[model samples]
Target: TFLDAVSRARPEIGDYPFTTIHPNVGVVQTKDGRSFILADLPGLIEGASTGKGLGHQFLKHIERCRVILHVIDMGSSEGRDPLEDYEIINNELKDYQMRLLERPQIVVANKMDLDNAKENLERFKKKYPDVEVFETTTIIHEGLDPVLRKAADLLATTPTFPIMDDEGTESSVLYTFEEKRPEIEVTQVEDHVWQVTGTKIERVFNINKLNTEEDFYLFADRMRYMGIDAALREAGCMDGDTVQLCGFEFEFIEN
Candidate 1:
């Protein structure tokens, strides 16, 4: 009752091209016949916690991964600072989900062929003496077997889910999608001019870049066409009313 999925592809699917990177999520059955889910999350950078650079997206993918494999670019010729990069990514992961801090971690020092990599590995070992590490160079297929073997061994030992207390029950949270219509308040600002504000209108304004007359007209048209005009009209907005966004105020002339 044991199985394994092997991929000989240069880079596994759904991964960004080049720089020896791959993102994968799959179930692995151990030699002992136990199965568990695993995820290969993308390396993160500083400001990832704030969703600065696909950090939030990447973090969300690993939310279900009980274990983490942090692969570092050991060679780092293109100015990829490993230590700081490691710290920044870890911080982002911790920030996104606190539970990730408790997950078991392993570090993979990749690209050991470069001269700087040996020096960096020495520094990394000295700094993080306790971290389990595996060095590999994908170009020549060197040191990969040991790394894969260790990963498989670690996975075999790691549990699928966090151990729960005897008395602790799961969360009583239930989610449902109920399409509720937007509640707009009809406020008479001065005269026939009414302020039309809601999540629907605000979201439309956010994505619309009014760089040209055509774009501006398109924005207005979208707002009006999305029944926003009808709602405003029903809310007592006259044809000659003044419409004000967060900063820019426009004359609400229905053409």
Candidate 2:
């Protein structure tokens, strides 16, 4: 509901609670031509700093976010105090390895339509006088414009936090590739049965898999150019021998 209020990109909406397996993104462009991306990252429980309840799965995405819009249920619809929830989330951000609390954060008091929401909001304000919070009832699209504009303004000034410490910050590959395998391998698996195995052989077979004579000639010509015929003869493949390649059987012939 809040995501829809932010960008109006209406995705699936349900009342039941579910795990956010991955994040969803939406863009917001203010009237003054300033724009920023907002990601709906959920699943931050009490122990998110130590990787609990989809903690690491979601927190890793926070490293790149320059601003965090922490939405609190002021309505207490879930029977939890708003003040406690605020502290818990900020604590988790503080405990995270990336020092996430250092980023600019905008507090949101959501679900203002529910009962006791105003009372809880008063109590929350009394507890944290310095913190500025925007109130909203996302279900009905109430009190959303100020929040959107404020987020865009903050993004205009807030620089992105460095996710890595080393100089290899320019998209470096992580994995070391294995040594190259031969393109073609001609093996004598039996007395007269020769099995030709290789990635190129399989690719050729898969492409020219038709049973027509013209297709077979094109396939044989590709194999010849790749030196499979000479490799087979060197492996002691004789004329009239049964050659198997990618499960297709054909009799060998010496030209």
Candidate 3:
């Protein structure tokens, strides 16, 4: 049983160059009221064992995970053979952590609704007979509930560990709210309009709908206070230029 089966997990906060250390960890809460962290480590590549790509960083994050959800793009739109892609990732993980090779990994076949996905799935199964795969179409929202339930069940039975481990030292699980300072990268796209992106800004926009003047003001104030105004000025954004959020666009002006 896997407790959390997500296609893509990014850092809570990010800078110009993303790194192995995450700003904030992802958490999944089950019906029984238990919560488990879904840590997003760097992805494993073909030569990750030999310090290729971010393989070492990616393997370290899985060390604390009870189960591994190997998410694969089954559509083959990325222009690589699906089975080879899976094998490359699997080999990298094996090279980085031999113990991880023994851990239960659920093959999450994503992009199932694509035109060529079924053929790739068939090929994948033929090559890896022992793997258990779950199909999902993220865009259409199909085959998601069952995956969630399976993830919860797996987490319930999995053992836990400290995020930062000490050699041969036993530790216990505990929740700590050590506040993480947010890292946002703001680029000036035009005069008075700053192109802003980061986990903090996105989450704030997701939870706050600017239907009212007050909401819009709150959002504006946040941007100004976060030094987005300075970034916009540096980018030469004019007062009337258009700026955008999640999906909504707004005109730039001094409040």
TM-scores for all candidates: the values are 0.52, 0.60, 0.53
Q: What tens digits encode model 1's per-residue C-alpha lDDT throughout 20-39?
A: 12254456444455555555
lDDT of 2 at 146: 89
**Model 1 segments more than 4 A misplaced:** 1-6, 9-22, 25-38, 162-255
> Highest lDDT, which number?
2
Q: Give the CA lDDT, 0 to 100, for residue 79 in model 3.
A: 53
lDDT value for candidate 2? 0.73
Worst 10 residues of 3 by lDDT: 14-23
lDDT for each residue of candidate 3 in 1-255, tens digit (9 for 90 to 100): 121244333432222111122213566654555555665443444565764323454466577677776778899764557888788878776776546766567678888888999999998888878877889876676676555667777776766644554566576896869456355656655444445556677666567544344555676667777776666666676665655443233456644
**Global lDDT of each candidate:** 0.59, 0.73, 0.60
Q: Distance (Å) between predicted and true CA of 100, model 3?
A: 0.9
Give, for candidate 1, the lowest lDDT window spanning 10 residues. 12-21
Winner on TM-score (2 vs 3) = 2
* Best prediction by TM-score: 2
- The RMSD of every model to the true structure, in order and in angstroms, is 15.9, 20.6, 12.2
Candidate 2 TM-score versus the reference:
0.60
